[model samples]
Target chain A: MTSAVLKPGLTPSRVLIYAVLILACLMYLVPLVVMLLTSFKTPEDINSGNLLTLPHVFSTLGWVKAWATVRGYFWNSVAITVPAVLISTAVGALNGYVLSMWRFRGSQLFFGLLLFGCFLPFQAVLLPASFTLGKMGLANTTAGLVVVHVVYGLAFTTLFFRNFYVSVPEALVKAARLDGAGFFTIFGRVLLPMSVPTIMVCVIWQFTQIWNDFLFGVVFASGDAQPITVALNNLVNTTTGVKEYNVDMAAAMIAGLPTLLVYVLAGKYFLRGLTAGAVKG
Target chain B: MATLELRNVNKTYGSGLPDTLKDIQLKIAEGEFLILVGPSGCGKSTLMNCIAGLENISGGAILVDDADISQMSPKDRDIAMVFQSYALYPTMTVRQNIEFGLKIRKVPKAQIDQEVERVAKLLQIEHLLARKPGQLSGGQQQRVAMGRALARRPKIYLFDEPLSNLDAKLRVEMRTEMKLMHQRLKTTTVYVTHDQIEAMTLGDKVAVMKDGIIQQFGTPKEIYSEPANLFVASFIGSPPMNFIPVKPAGGRGRWHVPLATDLGQLSLPLAAGDADLDQRELILGLRPEQLALAAEGDSAVLQARVEVTEPTGPDTLIFVTINGTKVCCRLAPDLAPAVGEMLKLSFDAGKALLFDAKTGERLARESKTPAEGSAGNVAQFRGR
Candidate 1:
């Protein structure tokens, strides 16, 4: 039996706290459990039993069909997220380095403008972003989606990196400058090497965000070029074919798995990176 | 080894703001150690930064080797600096920290290794080469910071209070080490510090600054013995210079400053050139060591009751109320006075300085030998 966190004995408040926590956990876990169970069931079994019930017969048919349906779009999501995440993170680091360390006239105001981009709702940029992509001859392409994600992802990534870099002593840059290290050299050696935690935060954040992004994916790309989120939406919402709940559940699970795995593997660093700047002197 | 000259250097944050460094002028010969000493926010560090090319000067020029470097970037200036915080690269090991500068300047791989080894051995950190800054103690980190600056044979080195963070014992140890290092390297160096002892001990030339202006620039002895003004005199002494106000008097023709002692009033005569001091408040500046116990027959003795006694091992400090202000006198430990004992004090008359109380500027004139008749304080007290 797990003991209460604050007191070893089973106090009434401790019991009440654990009760509220367990209920919260179940509220989140229940949907995942339902998805997990339904994904393994045949459509007939899914209809016959409720969300929690075990399948009468476990079948690979749903898994096979979901993979067949979303396989191409998964690769597209990878293409969009991989380049988008890397480019956005690298640009953000440079932006952060300049903003925090090599400040020029109006740099703070520029950063203020850049930060304004972080608060901008994605819906606000849809029309202009589409127009720009169309002008660049990138409409309805994976390249267009990648560009959209990178442009959108930059605000948050820069915010993360800038906040982290601000806590780094300006003396470090001064010392580096006196050591004969120029701007890029200082960033590469003195700063970027010390930026691993923030990098982890940026990569994980951008990866999951871009992978799960359906708005830009749907707006910028079309048909076969749609990301896994768009593909999953299409697969789940179709009314023309008989509603296959099992396949729909499996497809949704498949689309969500990469982000889930990324979180599970690196969740500790993401949280650690966010608080590292705040607690540091 | 290079000579550094700051010619009419002026810096301001913006058009309307007061200058951070105002019309600063200084020159140090090759291999000289120059110290900029002052209190916090005195612009010593800012001047050092301007010298290092980290901060731009709004006017004037900095020359290294007699060439203008004010327009050059820090990298192009060939200057090295050790920050007060050490500023050691946190991610790099000791070796990498030392190697970084050489590698950035594109020195050969073999030369980089050789340079790192040289600095490591010189700083006595050969064993710490593999360890990161986080794993090192404060002193060790400081050594690595020095090692990084020393790795390159730069024209000039700037140290911005590099040892201020260490414990007292270590700070003293480092002060000696810094002087020794300068003697060996003989590079033109500029150092900034608030601690007067470090300024006195380390610099071949000391510049005492306050409020962004260089108040006095001279050798340690000159700065100590002939401080340009009240601030410099007060700032450069350990138990800072005692500044006692000279009591203003009613009879103006004689210009004798009055001091009320336990025995009687002592009148000090001012010269004809000091006639201007008659209308204003006057101050007398004397070092604690300048005050000594009066011999029985001494002429210019201050008679007062001792208020406190502090025996600082090397010397004893006896505090007495003189002219209503607490005054400190340094005497031999064996002659330590008991608290509340009445004591007779006499100061070196020639070295005594007078200042205008309001402006805090030294009132310079030929030495005044305080009238010998004032010594009657001891005789008067004894007779009573």
Candidate 2:
């Protein structure tokens, strides 16, 4: 019995951790369960029935209507998010490689400015940036939303790549240089191959940020190009008609699926990168 | 094979920072192994970086085969370096790690495979070829790191304490393997280490460095037998050479040094005409192996009380007080002496060295061996 507690298979510490994890999972599942139950109910049933009770009849009507209500905006969100994450991560990796390896005057200052931008409040520049987008004829378009997300995500993506690149031994770079690899060769062959873990974090982080972004879409996207976040707000706020709680909850779940799938797929790298950064120094 | 030269190389971290490597001028012959030995912060690694083109020299030219390579990028410089941390690409299998350089250079696929096989076999790491660096032991990782360098046919190789992370027994094994590998390849290599034994046994020429300056550069035998100053003497040996202080006594033609110990004052004969005799105060340099228990009459025997004895399987180190300084004597294991016993010791006077007590420079002299039984009953005192 004592040995059982000492063994990792069913140790007391392991049992306690498992219990807490189960509780946390239930806590997270509560809101999702409520949303799912409400989505299956008729508008009156959603307002009048016990939330925990099983429905006498289940229907796909809520999903059908939710798909129709904001389908264009959901497609727009995907269109903007995909390109924005790719652009931000690509540019950030290049900047990170140069900053980490090369020693030039003002390199420190450049990095300092980039780091400073990461902590700046998004609201502080929103008005002026929106005005600039208007002047540049990028306002009220999917491109405009993409630009905003890319700008906001650049600092974080660059930091991830920069820290990862710095951990690569300088000797490897030198060896590559002696082997006739120039700047691009070293990046392509050495740094890039060694950076899978960091890249996974970058993609997952920037994808989630761009997908869930409400402010950028609300300010920049218009009409047919509005993202799911903006459309979901519209669906909730249209006061002239009866509010459809079932469709609203279903639409919200549909809008959240992309980020959740990405998180699950890349969670290993995301957590590993974070823990490695803490200990590698 | 190529000759390399660093002509007045200078490296400073920043504009106002003190120079890490200052006006370092060196020439390494083709197919020679040059070992850089120094304490930490002595810029040995920095020098290796400059040679590998990893660190840019602030001033001066680096020439390979008499052509200036100072401005050449590391890739074009044709040098390979094995780092202190091994720096194995953690994600790559050992086979890929060895193939990386060849792949970068666009070597033929079939030939790359053959070269990898060769190095893996040579380093006896063929079995680890499929494993990642993390899965292998430290000693195995070190061999893979060396295999990576061996896969490249660069003009020179730089090793920065490559075996420092291994266990003591493995380090000794690798040290012998490295010597044998160097002998076979005849490659021009620069190895940096603080281990004096490695420096002594590995290099064709060893440079003793201190605070960014090369104190002396010569064969290990020369550096050992004729050290440039007190620092080299103190730094180069295990159990280090003992430095005993003394004052010149008696008149001309018969110079003697008065050693004051807890046992009593005894006069040790100095080689006549030793230049440092004029200085009055001098330091006597003796290797621990040179001192022995005096069993026969000897002219220059000094009596001291043994304080401690350490017995290893091969030899025993007996510690005694001489001229108020603790001196260690390496004696055969069977010739153990008791603690607190008065022991008369004899040393070959011909091998005795005298130094300036102030400047610590060696005093020039022709030393004569002590005549057995000529200096009378001094060796008869095993009395205590």
Candidate 3:
């Protein structure tokens, strides 16, 4: 008798949700499908408006030529992103620990300034940042791009973890203090271990930002140091031959894959980390 | 083992705000269990936090073993606190949480494991070692929290309403376990709780506080029977000590307290040394259990209409009116009286207390000469 109600409870929400979800999923997938089909097509197939069709002759030439000519820029993206995520996450955690636990004069002011960084548009800072990087001898190198990624990433990552660590009961920290743990000890042993979800969120967010960056690479990097975003743009709109849309699509997918895998793997915690201290209490 | 003495300690959040702990003076002997009992926001938790070094004292010295530790960091205080929320590291398993303190102290891994196992077994959380705090029930979580503190073997243990979150049966069981553990360990401990029964049963000495000031500091029995003031008297008892405002109508030689009820005027006997009676405003404090059904002729007997009767299995609480004030009489379950019926109640005047109604100060006078045969075990109830 209870199963009668339980049946609808389980099946109704799932049925309705899955129905709408599948339709939504298809809508999202259509663009990516079109992009992939274009990436595989010859310039003629793309111009002919046969965009969503399979290649008449399946070709790896676009992939081969793109990899040979444009793969360094892809490597440049990896170079910029990996170090950027690592540096920003490490610094952000420290910033969060300080903001959450310690009380000092102007600590709140400093945090307010960092939060303000999140609201500022990249376009507003682009000219000055470019000039600053050039003056600092980091203009077009992977290091310059890394510095930019880390700068922008810091605001979001610090804000993410600052709020995360704030909800960790102050009593636990006090208990640790009475247990003979110092500030760094508590942060390393207690706060850091509990910050897995928040760290994953920061890492995924920063990885996507740095990996999918077009503006920074365009403004900063002039040559071989340009990232895959620059490379993908160049592939689609080069001055030489007609664009290889299939290769462009594939490269875009490849550049986006790291963040996709991150979300797919740690998606549950990512969602949890985003909405912590909401209903969980 | 150490003697903890708070000498004129005062804590204020800010200059303009009232003090949270006002000129608090207490001396707890080595291995003595001192229970700070008070209502919420009465500064019991604040006192505990100050003692644990979690909160800083605004004035005076807090000495442990004759050494001032007011400025010491919480880590240097050798104190372990079991918080009201349990405050177990939610991410860690029971075993890990217990071992955290030992690990911080750089204890050898083997010793940490052994100590963790010992406390886990003592708390009966051995089977829960692998489980996270979220997996455990509230009672189990409370045990693990206690285990974390016990693993440290610190100079003193502080419990801030540790069992308050548990259900009734579990709270009673935990109370018993706590008493037994204190007996076995003999660790100097200070516990803060609002439950008067817990305060009465657990502590060698109890400090009752109200509005940031210690109302009375004495053994549980003392606080119960000879509360320093009207507030303490009223706060300590279960159905609560009934306070009936009375006036000293007659001169000292006559010594009378006038009753102004429908039952007719009755003049109760008063003690000789009630100097505050000159003001004609005094409060009569009668514990519910002290008032009894007048079986036969008894001293200080009065007849009043029973307005309410509550039979609570073991005893019946009978409410009656005396001089326009509601008075409670605790009678045996078999002696339940019908509501609206006139019930004659008697009280031993020796058990009654007089307080200055305006100031809430005790009159501090012996009511009657001790009975010849009944030398009075009542003093035993004073300062247990």
Candidate 4:
């Protein structure tokens, strides 16, 4: 009926749009579903004539073997990612606050130079960065990878925090100053508390970037210090043994789970932070 | 309470540019409430920022309680301000917003709690203590802003058009509440507003500024009755002071202004006359209340046809033309005249003011006693 279309219920156009959206979602989700099913499948079931079908017999052997193989690299990724995310986010926050609030001569040019870092491709900097890391006595170590990620990640994190904090009213800063709050007090009490959403966005972005990084892990770290991403690559491509597709799938899922969990946990704030126009002039 | 003084204050955004504030000078005694009123772009907010140490003055020293604080930061200046937008901490509850200043000062937790409760009860926002700023209405946010300033017993409080964002009725109510609060606290304060009514009613002293210059500074009564220039006279009144061009009549010693009305023309005697008056054109500044309904035997009455009538509850404004300039005459609602009808209007010659037509300055006048009934007329007009 015409009333049905006019009311809050679905119309023909709505159904069409929903159908397209569902198709797109399913297309994107197929790989994740296959990875999850294969991680829980025995090697025999994976090779059977049912690539798209659910596992007829479930097994944890693939997961057990994958965990045993990549556990050390998994811990290395954790060690490299946590410090990189924290240090980059903190430095970005201070840089953002100064750039937005305590502007001095040539601050805009400085921010522009920092923004230029975001556009520089890793391939362009790889050789020089490795040389610099060797001179600094940090090459082929997890610490070297941490240093690289923090340095590269700062450009993106600083951009996010600066744009976010620019939307905060200057009057709030002035008010806090009048209330006897000096630099750090104002930052800790007024600005930082109001920065929860922006921090979520920055932290999540940095976490995912550092966790999923493969080139930095391979070039800057070695056998004992390489992150899980590099180890997973090596494990999957090694042609010396039987092709353990189930084990490779399980290791890939393990490498991606942390970032997926972070997105799921803080996705609402992520969206709001992306769109909030916090203050009017 | 403290005396605040600004000596030869000057501000310019950059070299080779016109100054935004020019050699401003003002002084407020302890516990005095000074209102800075002007139209938009008048540098009133700029002046407020200079006084609050939010903006450094390019040229002078600002002193509080006889101590020059020009070099001190805003926090060290020991002053509080209420911004026009309220500027409440969005993430904090009302109680937390009020306690923020004291907390920053490292006040004890017990004292902070007591001060928060006191201001909440004083502003009648106790029920809203746990609510965030976004959850509150505009008026509630305004009270929370005021409460934040009030919680800090600073040397001076600055309010930069705090009630400007409120609706008309709420503005009026808050205006009264502000006056009452000021009376109770007796704290030295400077308030900036564009509303003339607020300037007239709330200020112990009013400073009118325009184009970055202080046009006049005095009590409200002096500002209304003895304005120093044409701009001050024109800016301070509602239904603004009417200006009619007039030519001098009679000899130099005894000047009269000839005004054209519906009844041909009439010459109103000037209270002050000078030898140079006959050679220069003049403007006559008259408030609407100065023009009244003429009695039957009134000697100096000008007849004019009413162009329009606006009844504003307590009184009616009748618009008429004299010398081709539309003039508004405030009369009681009972005397509402019909449009296009001729009415006899009498001008109070003793209350009339003369301005130089060329420079917009008040012409020198001979000393004369103040008008008797004008005070009562001003009271009646303001009572509405």
Highest lDDT scorer: 4
Better of 3 and 4 by DockQ: 4
Top candidate (TM-score): 4
lDDT of 2 by residue, B1-384 (tens): 799887888889888888888777777799999899999998998888888888889998889999999898787888888888887777679998899889888899999999999998899999989999889999898899899988988899899999899989999999999999999999999999999999999998788777776766667776676666677778898789999987877766577777766766667777757443654677888899888888786766677888998887788889998866899999888887788878888876666778777787666555422122223211110000
Candidate 2 CAPRI assessment class: medium
The residue-level lDDT of candidate 4 at A98 comes to: 90
Those runs of model 1 whose alpha carbons end farther than 4 Å from true positions after fitting are A1-7, A10-16, B247-256, B269-280, B365-384
- Residue range A1-281, candidate 3, lDDT tens digits: 88886666657778899899999999999988886776677666667776677877666666677677667877888889999999999899999999988757899999999999899898999999999898999988889989998998999999988988888778888888888889898889888988898888888888888888889899999878898888778766777865566667777766667778877988888887888846555
| True lDDT of residue A238, candidate 3 | 71
The lDDT values for all models are: 0.85, 0.83, 0.83, 0.88
**Candidate 3 lDDT, tens digit per residue, B33-128?**
999998899999999899989889999999999999999999889999999988888878889889988888899999998898889778888899
lDDT of 1 at B222: 72
lDDT (C-alpha) at residue B70 in model 3: 92
DockQ of each: 0.85, 0.55, 0.74, 0.80
Per-residue CA lDDT of candidate 1, range A134-238, in tens? 899999998888888888888898899899999999999999888888889889888998888899899999998899898888888888998999989888888
My TM-score estimates for the predictions, one after another, are: 0.92, 0.90, 0.92, 0.93
Pitting candidate 2 against candidate 4, the one with the higher TM-score is 4
Candidate 4: stretches off by over 4 Å: A1-22, A278-281, B368-384
Sorted by lDDT (best first), the order is 4, 1, 3, 2
Q: For residues B48-84, what per-residue lDDT tens digits would candidate 1 score against the true structure?
A: 9999988999999998888999999999999999999
Stretches off by above 4 angstroms in model 3 are: A1-25, A41-49, B272-276, B366-384
Query: Candidate 3: which pairs clash?
Result: A38-A245, A38-A246, A39-A245, A39-A246, A40-A246, B222-B383
